[model samples]
Target chain A: MTTGAKRPKRQTAKRTPPKAPPPWDPSIVVFACNWCSYAGADTAGVSRIQHQPHFRMIRVMCSGRIQPGFVLRAFEKGADGVLVSGCHFGDCHYIFGNERAVEQFEKTKEVVKLLGLEEGRLRLEWISAAEGVRFAQVINEFTDQVRTLGPSPWNGKRQQSVGRAAGQRPTTES
Target chain B: MPELAEAAKKTKAWACYDCGKCTATCPIARVGGSYSPRRHVLATNLGQQREIVENNTLFTCLTCSLCDRRCPAQVTYTELVRDLRELSHGHGVEPECPHGGALQSVMRMMAKGGTQQNRMGWLSQDLKTESAKGQVFYWTGCTMYYDAFFPEFQVKTLEGTRSAVRLMNKLGINPVVSPDERCCGHDLLWNGDRKSFELLAEHNVKLVANSGAELLVTSCAECLRTWKVDYEPFFGAKPPRIVHVTEYLAEHLPDLKFDTDRAAGTGPDGDGSRGPVRVTYQDPCRLGRHLGIYFAPRQLLEALPGVELSEMRRSEAAAICCAGGTWSNCDRFAKQIQVERLREARATGAQVLVTACPKCQVHFRCAMKDPNLGGEIEIEMRDVVELVDQAVGQK
Candidate 1:
């Protein structure tokens, strides 16, 4: 064949460039309702339950106060996963606080998933104040799942670099 | 091409179930069942660029989200309609503006950076309004101007703003209100005029920001929705807390002086003291479905003495959109919907039809006065804030 014309004859010797694995250590953010989920998280720590230690938790008075903006803010701040937990459905300390959370979760989940953030990355659960073991289990499971998903596209750490143009200094947010 | 792609993803116009559930439940289609939303989606998929932009159906949509809500495929038909309007605008195939384009022109003029607007001409000296220095800013959005535009309808929409101010003043809270405040760009955005929407949004945001107001209170439901939902996301900054007057007032109602003695004559006993006036509320779509604020307006009415708060059959999430919502979509369908809605309100034995938005007041009043109806639907349309004002004092 003429030089630079057509040269795809060999099929045996394939030189595969090594694929670099994603950062497996996930940074998670959790918004725990003060009346139940926050207490549940505290119980988990006090009981010495084994769970992932990579979450920054913010305690809101009620799950009803956890707006979609708060969840998206966490993701933007480099969170690989966000867990929004409140009281059991009917056991909300403030009557129907968890009901409000459930209502907002439906809309928020759709938007979160649409942003290419896998549905699992943004989770909503009803964890009671006494469910310390369940809370720990959820954390461990969520951490592992997020680890498989790798770094979040919205992660502040990565976006600063990804969005940077050639020669522009990286943002100092991360 | 980029706009088309983004619009596609936003609307899920590509997601085709071909089930026609959207068309089945669409209010517009129910009126005729011709020009179905499914056809629009099919047209979109076929890349029928010319027909999509130039067709009358593009401007006929109420943008009410009924189709979007009922779509089994979860396709956002409302957003699709909006994006189509944008494409139509790009292709220069705009609909005939309802009022010789006067209203649209006023809104567009407000967007050109700094245009001095005497929006506060409705403010009376008797009402205690703080300068642009209070912690709470009252957003009297286009109420005075709406009064000027629809003078024939005799809808004193500015009365809502006055009532809100009076109620706030009675509560010992002085709210900042400005004459410089322009349109909230609610119509412009939905009409596919994003450039004008952005200009108005940025201008209003900066104006409110400079006022040093911690919270922005609006009696207008559309204004509250636009400011809270659209402007906040676009600004990328912590927008000042935006609240509907009903919500803001209801939140602080615990300390309100509900002096029941003055409501004597309005009572059912041919006296306002204790008997309740039979009233039905028109849930402004922006207030009810868009912001999920169905209860606040009702709560105020229910709490007021000599007020019987009745529910319209299609209230709350299923509330019908106001007839004069999108200026681009003005048609016989819009007027017919308003007339029918008025009949529903009148059927409830509601002497007074209470609504939270000025546009609702204007449209309902216009329909009520139509000779075609022959004055059969005789119902007084009043803003809930006006009732609140009367409850507080005689003036």
Candidate 2:
């Protein structure tokens, strides 16, 4: 090449940023009625039934005690899924508590859906005190559903920032 | 104590002059509650922090600002209450909110962010909306949550919002409706949850900035006040031009066409070709006393071909509150206030009670559902936008 000739510029390789790792281990909150679902969970434990351990159970006296606020609060505090479990319609210890739970569940589900959460994230089920297999099955199914959906959009960095912004301590749980 | 002193100074609670005008004008006080605005001011002026904090009456003030209108000394009684509430809330005291605080929780959750809201479920096929960014941004403002929460009331809160969009579409403007938009935090701020309110305000302000909107329109009166007044500090220098839907519609009144033939028989009387429908208007406190928008809704109603405006005795600046505000202290006093307001509407001989606020509609409907009232206060309540939508006819 001549001394006056302009040398071609060297091609710089475009640096592609590494992709973010896939989010794992969805957190779920389960409101279990003390009369049935909670007992059923205990039965599942006693029978050595293997199930997903991703959910934390809150034992309310009845599912009727699980108001829309409770479910919304769970989601607000960064739950990936919420399962409200009670006794069957006619089997509530207080007779109409389960029926009232159905009403409350419907209200909570509407709010959860409107908040842009996946419908699969919220579930309501009836389990008797003896249904250990059913409890395990529900746990496995719910955990799988949440897994496919990945970590909640309401969790992670954004939630932590919100907590900080609101002058509350950031929760340690994922 | 320093905060209390600061709040008193900021809100001009020092200018009370020992006048009982605020107490006299207070709807809550008139309903025979021990909650007196005058007393609250006195407590603040005297630096009685313990009494102010201990009294549950702090949460009972509607912050309607009617007293502000009547305060000869120019004392902002509403802002004083708000400041006091903020101070009290900082002390870990909470308002005994109605609905088991479900609505408050919803608002707080919205403040927390990160959820992709399905707020557009109410957007039917006909109503046009921009997906990303536009000149006009429409804030839906918790109507979706309200609809789901108060299904027993059978009030279609989203119907008002959808109608608003329809009206905008008629004017050839497809407003930006963001699913990412959160609550305007009116109730949270009024509820004295300042931290949550600030978070929501920041989120909404940033979202609006991202949308690059010049005009922000909302259907809820409370949202209008929140965005226009409460979000001012967070917005810094540039904020979107905000207007209530009625104000927006009123501005474009000349261009809008109403099919009077379609609206002729919408009155209680099914007679197709009779006189214009007699409708009374309830001035929402936020739209009237707070924002000084007394005529926009009336102008729109008057423009409708077959709708006649009937003024309640308590109209404009003198209008009463919906009794239940920010979803707190909804006790018998609130019920009594609602019942009285509804009776006033009934007395006006209007077939329909037209209001611009969804919360007003909800509260009135709840009062009407009282088993003892026996339908005495059961006038058909309609949002002003809904009536306009009905008159404009479907495209």
Candidate 3:
């Protein structure tokens, strides 16, 4: 169940230095809870569900542990889209952790929109430990949405804007 | 006024020697109102119930406690005014409320039980918030509704709420902030509706108390005042600790810094520049003299490198009330007072006027809407939390 592994380079005509540095492909960050969505990704592989290879997953004990900062950091580090999938409500191993996840996810979604990030770049879903097909479908759908957004403005120095730079480096006293 | 004359004597409202010092220091008196504190006291003490009640002068008082500071007789003029207002209500004589009393009506409606509110609609997408579970609870107190009601003011009143969450997030505390918060009952209680006030108070106290947060923070001055002062009597016993956003940020100022990269130098208007933006402060009466908090906001403002704390002439304890708030007592005198305060702020050469209350921005912006005015407001008005949020690189 690993994703976003480096693939074999495609043959291309020799190009000048001014050409694009790499192939254009979507990059998505997936936040999966230890008890549910993380294991679901494993189930996706065991069942061999065909899905996009754009996801890079990070596992936490509970989806409720994710903060807006983590999402902002992912975007700041060049994530074109983010997928937050936790256990279905009421089925959370932690009892109410998925509920908290849902609320916090809704909260961060609005903050993302205010920061000028497209609504399609961030998502929240409930994919239980057994929902491998659902997990794969979620990744594929998110990849298509992010594909239309092209590269995140946070991709590299070439994409940096004054606002994004200032946003990333909020000043604090020495 | 007659029924309160006896209670007034107990509070020493009968001791006015007609020295007129209260009149001289009164903002309303200076505005040529017949409702001067000196005159009101003299009339009420002399048993001029018919005249005082007929003229409906009791509502004009801001209850700011300015005259009490200089009253040689220590007459407790503000307390007397409150008593008189209660009596006037008992007599079924009430002062007129602006906006056709729509805001007051909403407060009255909230006082009743079983009203549902979509208070959380103002929550921005990325702002982190907690349910009734975190250690710190932020009381937004009717600001969300006000922003919608007074959109003509063009002020993002709820941005203060949003920034408050962001600021708290930066402080490393996930605040237990709920949009389900009821009005703190400031206007209802001050306007002499004890029954309604208690109803609203009971609802709010239960909500916050259930949140398990020992500390409560609010950006609204009236809410802070109600929590700091009024919550004790209605709810009984000391309630959760309540801190204004200014106080909270000031205490954490050492841990915060201004955004050096965002300081693009003061461009024209709130240009997201860091050019040492000169800001004058409007002391909302409830936060200042009403609650005795005049220093925290200044400390927070001074902590920003590009922010210069400019002082207005009527600042601190002597500051003029925004005039439009409190029981929705909006009137011509309140409008005049607001415009005059804006003039004082502009006179200080500050690019912005900072306040800890949302309605102050609403009142000033409403007054500036007058097309007949010589010019539009030259200075911008902002809430202290908005300033703090920007200093920490929040929108």
Candidate 4:
């Protein structure tokens, strides 16, 4: 049987191996407010709550500090999804920081949508510091949602091809 | 430093003979800022690269090209500022962009490519647009972004773009409006981000080329100048002929039908019922001084029945800038320039301050928000296309 299998090696060489695309995992960026959502993420960690491990947390002083630029920069740098988590309304440490975050998030949402990203890819949620299980739930939910949407158009292969296409174009003048 | 000398030689900054005309003509200098085109030229000529970069006047220039008009030696002052800015940007010196650089970040993100944009959300059911191939391609620029970013301004930048398309539709032409059309990179190039600008330009050039369009029409003055002047040299063979929307519409003046009666009675302040609706033209520096599109907009405005075109004191080549350009250095100086320009517009005795540039509309409206000004400079602002669309009776 081993000799028979070896006899087909010449036939195998004539056929190309099937190219299996690498299994894709969502790359999510979570912008957490230091006073609330960041602490919530910490609590989830300390509680050993099992959440999706795909997200990277960036702690900002206040939710208001997350400008549209911050979220845009994340997408520009090829983030699959971005979650801007903040303190609940009226529960903000600085009185109205979360309110301002709502305003900024609306603007960011418009830009993100206009840029043709999936509506679910960008989200704003109010997570309290004590809500460890809730943080884990949000994380797992967001990661699963992003996974269903597949890799962002800005991700690896598409980006490389775009660069290659631009490079291939004729440059008639300097 | 050698790049600075090269820039100087290329722009003919060496031809400057210490003449104060450029300084006198500079809007920033007029507003009492230390920004002088002549001073920068002298510094570049003397090879004082460090002084020029550290002084940071390079970003302060509005690059309106007004100084180019005043220069007897024909020195291209605006190009010098642009090249110097490109150098400064390479050295990691970033401009103090307004709105905390949110707008700039949006533009930079677009430059990255491969981000599919839903730019056609503004295209309504009535407006006919072809996506794949057409003779005319309408480049929307960043109107949708601006509309979302500055909702408080109530300028409705996208509305002007929509009006442009509607006008084209009325002329029995279905323009190709690409959803993948990116920013013209006018702001990025002027802000000294050459690499990002090139990326956007390449994407746009390829998009238009693939669309098989022979004529590319844009409503934005900055985008028009960018496509016509900056992007032309870098484009591959057989680039489409770029024209401003007003310029294109002006050519087909005979074909356009306007409802003069409706336009006369539809003034915001109810003053149009008395006589022809008086509108003063605010020459966007890009359209006027840069592209020399002085008559096209005026020609279109005059063609609209019941719409009287009032020229401001500083109209045409002498027009003041919208104060803000390239989204950089929008400081008290910019506000002052805006306030003064608004006051001039108010003095023209025209109820409507009509401008062809969306930035001019945005800047002037922003200046009007000054609580202290208190209705003194509160003239109604409208884009030329919006008025034309109204006069044509949007079906």
Candidate 5:
């Protein structure tokens, strides 16, 4: 009984919890189309796999549903890289949906190049629902690729100050 | 029957994921209950072959790649749909349309080579396409010609393109222009007119080869994409090296110089209170998402002196469809889509929205005309090349 009563004396020693680690900058936003890519991502989660903490996923209907604007938005919003993963060829839950996405990806790649973003800031891949490992691999590889690119040139080029060069627009909060 | 199966064997449609994103983003699906790209996709993957081929959904696909832009799979949904539509048309299935048969009228024009003749309507006089004459063949697809609304753009772009080619010549590269160049089979293939697409593709490919051009250059994003993907797949061998005009410029930017006076100007405010006049950029679905060429245009924009470049909420991979390309103009919901996109563009607070592809400019203009959104904001839309043209000398 005396030992149990000893716990009540500790009220003066209130301990503050430790602060969480700082957020990862240049966050990677992955739009995983449902059916193939989303399921693949889910599998990666269920399998208790460890992947990059920077990747945030937005499950879309299909990779084809991803618009170029969405990727640009991610970059504008401070994401260093954007990845789109879907079913492989002929494997979209929606027939031919990936086909359209591939076409769009082709165009967006050129846009990425134009922005002077590092080569891998924007990526397109086909990951099947069964390819949980592949999904994780893509994330790892793309995350590394983006990390090498550092902050998007635009992140610093966006100049809010006047008299700065046109290309140097100050980065606004996306 | 002409190696259809053999050709079909080469396509990757067998890997579809059936996400229905294509249907959701499809402009046609919005208006016509007669079609569902999602259903067509599901049916196709399930090998419910009959339903996919027989249903009007196959045809109603604007083939715009909006769905593909959103698709996570990178399946090339638009291209697959085109392939399937071609097969369906070959098998005698007709697509349904709300245009009350106007699409057929355009198809007739395509068949008669009227599209070629109309390509340069922006020219003050009849403009003749000079032969490549053993140089690079420049493919000016239908939108540049028949769509008379974008005349200044076409003319200026042609001028810039010509200058760029001359610059290339200085660098030991000679590009050719084909007077007899045909359409790149974009409309025909997307419209479900397979026979016409094949005929045009064959004609254009043959014309390019016959011109003795080592590379094929084009201003149209759709034409470049079709030549690279659809046509290349058909021929097996690598076709001519296809280059978009913007790509060519980016390659030569170091050597190129521009006049600051022409490209940059003091704002109307005079005080320059704003940071380089917040200009938003719209990535054409084909130019931005399909081709993955997002940065070149941005680089060009950034290079402009005193220009503040902003972005729409969705750009690059998430860029919304203006719904202008792939026959979306024929759909009733086309206006609504245009309005929605215009709103997004305006929200960026950019006085000018710059894009690389001419079709995107056309679509943006169409969307801006809607009473609902058009009046809400006043934005000037210019092609990246046009902006470059302005930045450089008037040519």
Candidate 6:
């Protein structure tokens, strides 16, 4: 049975006081809606399933609330990875809410690259409240992907990295 | 490949297990208590064609992404719903919405310039067949051009779109425009006018081919959805590069200097004294759900500096439809769904409701006036372009 405690440090090194790691362990923020994805996480807890400890979740009423700018803001605030979880199509507590997330994911993928982030760093998934195992699997997979991508360019080298290469603006690469 | 598109293309109707989650969650599904996606999909798969098409449930769909966002199989339920509506229309089944008069009026206005076609008129002044002399053409859909109720919005749309064109021009790319541009079969396709849709598609595709313009840019979400998704298959040729105006604008906003003041939340009195307003945004189904255009509008809104953009309880993929989606044309049913949408928007505590689609703006505005919705909320609706227009001194 999984305990509700934070996972033991794995491949993470503590840095000097007052400063984040130079090659920081990636931070991920997941915005999960209450109806499906959030409940899925809740089910994971109830089921005693274990997942990665790389993410901090914020519960939203629906996946439709996830704006691409919020993902960009998370990235700007040093989030190396972001996950948006919603109900599968036709399962939203609000009709069409998950579909909006599906559409937004397309543009968000482009925007992430436009900001120079790696592909798959940000993900949109449809995880029902009953799918505890799926939720655990998605979190673990996303955590590993972010680990490979490393810290976002915006987070490291605060002084020298001002703009442009810092992934602030849209680029032709998207 | 986006999963929504892939799923929509692949999934068969019987895949749905009839969880009733989609109907229960739908903003419009509760209207008259007669709408249900699970039932509709089940019926369609069972070949209960006559019954499914005749039912008012199909029209109750706001075409919102809520069901799409929640489906476990990613069944693309909404597309199936749209197909049902088309079938119903094919059988000469008429929805209860007053869409007929509105669409006819809107189409007539598009043929002749009027207040409705303000944005298109603005385009006529700045762009022309001569300007769009290259191998590109702009499909000025009816919503952007002939929607008179949204004058301020139309102007802002032109300004932002023009800014993008200017940037492209500076980049040594001169995309052409045709003053003779007509609707891209968005309304016809959505409303089940398949024959008209085909004619317009053929006509527009031929026009673009003859003009030698390989690119097409439009500010309308519906146009982008139809042109890219529906028409491309029919043409059997590489479709033009159809882009939403916001996508084009975000690419160039940093280079353009514009002064915009934030209008967060204000009371019914339009007073700023109510402490910084807690503002939220609603994603139009086409722009947010169909096209994945959640960021561009948010970037435009967030760029205003002090505006605290709190998200709606249901946003992006999970957003409730404004109830004015293409299928909402069936009168009493559409209004019923609109009422539900108003309640959801009111729940956001956002004094000002912002969206990109003119249809959403109109529905939200009308819904706010319903006496049944508990005496009104001091909410104002505006397009994203209107806000940008105010910022750039074009207002």
- Residue B1 shift from truth in candidate 3, angstroms: 8.7
Q: Taking the tens digit of each residue's C-alpha lDDT, what string does model 1 give over A85-174?
A: 999988988999888887656656644533335788988888888999999889878877776665676454553333222222112111
Q: Label model 4 with its docking quality class.
A: acceptable
Chain A TM-score compared with the true chain A, each model in order: 0.75, 0.77, 0.77, 0.79, 0.73, 0.74
**Residue-by-residue lDDT tens digits, candidate 4, B94-194:** 88877778788778878876668888889999999998799999988888888887777777788899999999999999999988888889999999999
Interface RMSD of each: 18.5, 1.4, 18.0, 1.6, 16.8, 18.2
lDDT of 2 at B53: 90
Q: What is candidate 6's local distance difference test score?
A: 0.63
Looking at model 4 chain B, report the run of 10 residues with the lowest lDDT sum: B265-274
- DockQ of candidate 4 (2 decimals): 0.43
State the DockQ of every prediction. 0.01, 0.45, 0.01, 0.43, 0.01, 0.01
lDDT of 3 by residue, B1-395 (tens): 34756866767977778999998888777887666788778877888877766777778887778888779999888777777776677778665665545455556545553324557777777778897787889888777666655655686788888889888888888888775677788887777666778888888888888888888999999899888887876553546788998898888887786675564355325555655778899999888887889999998887775788889887898898888657546667777777888889889989888999997888888887877885656567788888778767742
Off by over 4 Å in 4: A1-25, A155-174, B268-273
How high is the lDDT of residue A166 in model 1?
26
Per-model CA lDDT versus the true structure: 0.76, 0.86, 0.76, 0.86, 0.62, 0.63
Expressed as tens digits, the lDDT of each residue in A10-40 for candidate 2 is: 5543454653443356689999999999999
Candidate 6: TM-score of chain A is 0.74
Off by over 4 Å in 5: A1-174, B1-36, B64-76, B91-130, B149-175, B233-238, B266-277, B372-374
Please identify which of the two predictions, 1 or 5, would achieve the higher lDDT against the true structure.
1
Residue B88: error of model 5 in Å? 3.3
Model 1 residue B296 CA deviation (Å) reads 0.8
Q: TM-score chain B for all models.
A: 0.94, 0.97, 0.93, 0.97, 0.78, 0.77
